[model samples]
Every structure is written in C-alpha cells, then in structure tokens.
Target: MKVNIYYGGRGLIEDPTLYVINKIQDVLKEIRVNVGRYNLYEQKNGISMLPNTFKEADAVILAVSMEWYGVGGLMQTFLDSCWLYADKQRIKDIYMFPVVVATANGERKAVEDLRGAWELLGGRVCEGICTYVSNRIEFETNQVYASIIEKKAEEIYRIVSHKAPMLPNSINSCHVEIPSAGIELTPQESEQLSVYVADDSFVKKQKEDVEMLSQMYKSILGKKSQPDSEDDLLKKLEKAFNPKEASFKAVFSINLNDVNKTIVLDIDDGKLKSSYSSSAKADITVNAGKDVMSKITTGKTTFQGAFMSGLITAKGRLDLMRMFDRVFVFEY
Candidate 1:
C-alpha cells in the first residue's frame, strides 16, 4: 500500500515529534511496507500539488503536533494546502490518521486542537496515538520514548492491516508512561558519576566544540546515512571509550557525583583513536544498548533542552562531554 507521512511544526533538528515520525517509517520498512514522507516545511513555499502517485495511495497519514495548545502554524499552512489538492481531486477514500506528540501535561489540549483541525478539513480521524515525552526532563536516550513510538506504530499498522474503519467516537490511544522511581544516589555513588562543570568561563566554548565534532562526524558518515546502517561508526565510538585503546585517551575528568549514574555512547574510530581512555573513571558506561541514544547523537534531541533537563549529562571535561551531543541523525 502506498503511504505518505506528513510533518508539521517549527522545524528543529532536535524535536522529538519529528523523531517519532521517523521511527514510525523505520518500523513500517522493517515490516516491508512501502511508505513515503513529505516535509511540510520543505513544501511550504512550493506550488501545492499532491503528486498523481500520492493520489493513488491506499492511505495518507497526517502526522502533526499541537504546539502551545494550538495547531502549529506550519501544520496549519500544510493543512490549508491540502484543501487546494482535495479540491482538484476526489480523495475521500484515502484513510487518514492523526498522530499527536504531546507532553504528559498537555496531551488533552493537544488532542482537542488536532480534532478541531481534522474537523475543519472534513477529514476522518482514524486511530490517534498520543505520545508523551516528559517536558520536565530531558529524554536524551531513546529508552522509553523509542519503545513507545514503535509500539504505537505497530498498533497503527495492525489497524490498517485489518482494514479497520474509523469509529464514530473512538480515538484509539497509546502513550509512554514516565517511570515512577525518581533517580537518587548516595554521596559515594554520586562521587562515582562523571561531572563536567559548565561554568561561565567555557560553557559556550564547550557547546561550540561539541557542535563542530558532530559536524565532523556527519561529514565522515555522510549527512544522509541512516542510524541503523552506521555500525562502523558505533564500533569506533565503543573502542574509544575502552581504556586499553591506546590510540585514543579519555579527554575529561568525570566526577560521577555530578552527573547521571550511567553514560552510554557510540563513538567513531578516528574519534576513538584521538580520545580513548581506559581508566576513564566512569561509574557506569555502555555502548548502544538502546536505539534512542543513536538518535540523540544524530541531533534528534535539542542540545540545550536535553542537557538542561538532564537527558544528556557528562563527567570529566565539560568540552569532551559536549561531543556526544552532535553524533546521531534523525531520519523523519
């Protein structure tokens, strides 16, 4: 079946909403489903035309987010453009679904706004998945968020596979639940964690260095490569974190007491050669245990928001800590 995924909102390299859409596409491919994506941001200035090929699609999913309790302006423009297309062709049979990314706190309002938009467009709302990422915290690692998106996508697929019709009042729902246990540590445990003080002296410099390192990796890996295909890059990053890798040495002095208990990473070979450290003095560290961290490195999460919310943290050199920020690419 032909499927088109649409993205609407202020475009940002780090936004999780777009990340979820990309994840859905990955899941669909894994199941051998052919799907295409159209970035509303890219199409905003173009002649609004739904390709004849798209018109032939079995289904078209409208994936959007309600930003600030209202339809995001970019999304609004995209929806309006679709009306122009709908007028030119009869698209009444194409199945439509609304996927809304919202925080646990703002979900209700987000859903309400999305429903209003669909009604305005005379579009039927099929299954709706409300993904909740904690706005109060940084979701640096994909962990819970990735799982939620995959599960939601699978649910949507199941519904589509069965040829399920939109229920009169049914807005099927799914979400990621925040963990109940708060992260806590003892003084000694804290001491074992990595710490990088972002003092006023070098915080901005550190951010810039991290951005440059990220760009360097992107250049070597090619900007368009998918995260799943970058095992070599992941392996290189893994070796760099190993203390025995003499070609590289750890560049920071992490104070475990000041950061999250664990640091998971995937590094490149050149980067490993230049910065591997064995006695790296990390309380806990691992490589690619979760798919989401790869997404984070690829710029799926906002750097400032992720760090500020502790989604990403570091020990040792504040400068070295920022290197992880630039590694992953979000292919939504």
Candidate 2:
C-alpha cells in the first residue's frame, strides 16, 4: 500500500500542480496509505538513482507542469534514467498515474506522452488528471476541483488495494526490451555512482587516472602520446577571453568523437577551467561533431552560425550560448 509521487515541476509558489498534488496527498494520507513524495528539482544530482525507489512502490504518480508545450525536462530526465537503470520486471507490475497541470497549452498532449512512456516501460497506465489553469487561486478554491482530486485518490486506493486488473496494451505485447546500463548495482551502489557522475571533482580524478594510464601504455609501447588538440583549444579559449561581467559561471560540454572524449569547460568570473569529463548540471550543453568543434576553435565558424547550419546542437539557457562568443572571440 505504498505510493510514490514524483513532482516534476519547478517549485513555484503559485503553481496549480502543487495545489492538486497536495490535495491528493492529504486524501491518501487520511485513507492510511503510506505515501512518499520526491521533488525532482531537489534531487537533480541523483536522478539516475531515483529508479531504485520504484522497487518498493506499488503505484507511482508522475506529476508534472506543462508550463509551455511539454512536460518539463526534469521529468523527462527521470524517465530516461528509469529506462537506463530501473528493474523492468518490477516496472511491469507497478501502476502509474499521470498528473499533468498546464498553465499554457498542451496538457492533453503531455498526458498522452506520459501515459505512452509509462506503458512502454511495462507499467500499467491509470486514468489520471489533466487540466489547464490560468488562474491558480480560482482553480485551488473550486470545490468541484477538490472533489475530483479526492475521488482520484480514492480510486487509486481501491484499485491498488484490490490488485486491480489492467487491460493489455499493444506496445507491451510486442515484447520490446530496453538494454540495461550493463552493470548490476545495489541501491546504495547506484546512488554512489550517480553522485560520482555529477561530482566534477570525482570526474576530474578519474580523468587524471586515465591520462596517467595512457601515458604509461604509450611509454611501454616506445611511442609518445599524441598531443590533445582539444586541450590546446581550451587553453587558447582561456587566453582569448574578454571578461564582460564581474561574476559569472557556465559549463559547456563539447563532444569530440575523433578523440573519443568529451571536454567540459567551466568558466567562473571569466576564469577558464577545462577538463575531460561530464557534468550532469551545466548552464549549456552542446553536442557537436569533431569538424564543427574544429571549425569553431579555428574561428572558421561561430557558435550561432554552426547552430543555424545544424552543425552544432545545444540545449539549456540560450543566453549562455550568446555570452560565449562575446567572452571568447576566437581568432585562428
């Protein structure tokens, strides 16, 4: 009788999604159901470990805010993490209820996406909540709205308690399987790995170890290790920097498939720091081919130009991308 609620909305004071979940939580508590809640915003660092929580949950509520057109990235990341690390056997039996609250448009589409995702993960999709509320106060104060939320909670309780039967879904019937992350880990181990993945210091240490090993192997083979062209580019970026503001920090993820490595650049107050690693939290993340990166570093192409030409892809804050060119005017 344990139900988990993962809130995938930004913690806004006036978010209607928060109001609805709170109401549902209260009703579930009154019915003596052991309810647990996880706010994805507060757990961004260890989202990859969250799928471990699914082991004990009989049912789960995937609640998210459709502020723009789709479910926020945090929820989508959580779902991706689950696909990568969760135990599919356990997921197949768990019931999933989607709670989508929209402040703009696309609530219905978001709901469908969530349900389809859950079903694809082999979870039972339950009829859940979906609505748009331009006026949070009005929606929260409406008695009918409150009643509907309470009824939904009651339905979950009865269905879970009685071991409700779920109709077959064609997607699940196809026996599609997602490959695991290739390693089995306990919950504690998964949490530790996730923490290490997000910790920049830990990743740096690992990179140092790898570099040391590479140098040793090169010496044993009687050959010199090739100079890291990308590393030189990073130093060049630092030398060319022109500071605009007093204090600012941003991380850029540059993928170089030629060297089979990803470079992370951390700029703090116009001071440049570079490493060969990954960061779960970055102001802006870019995925570019080696040619695109080479062109940008050589000043043959600009960040904006590469993006417009579909040579470089980026996500996160757009402002950071614009700021990069101003800070570092690359000259070949």
Say which candidate scores most in lDDT: 2
What lDDT does candidate 2 reach at residue 74? Answer: 99
Q: Which residue ranges in model 2 land beyond 4 Å of their true spot?
A: 180-332
Query: How would you encode candidate 1's per-residue C-alpha lDDT over 1-332 as one tens digit per residue?
Result: 45678777556765667777887787666545679888778877642443333444545666666555655776666665554334222243455666777643576666666565554444455666676666524653656766666656656555554345555432223232434457564564344332312234343553475576456445544645444334443454453343323343343322122222223332334343222234445422332223334444444444333432334443223333334333322332
For residues 26-45, write the lDDT of model 2, one tens digit per residue. Answer: 86776467899999999998
Error of 2 at 283 (Å): 51
**What C-alpha lDDT does candidate 2 achieve relative to the native structure?**
0.77
TM-score of each: 0.45, 0.56
Local distance difference test scores for all models: 0.50, 0.77
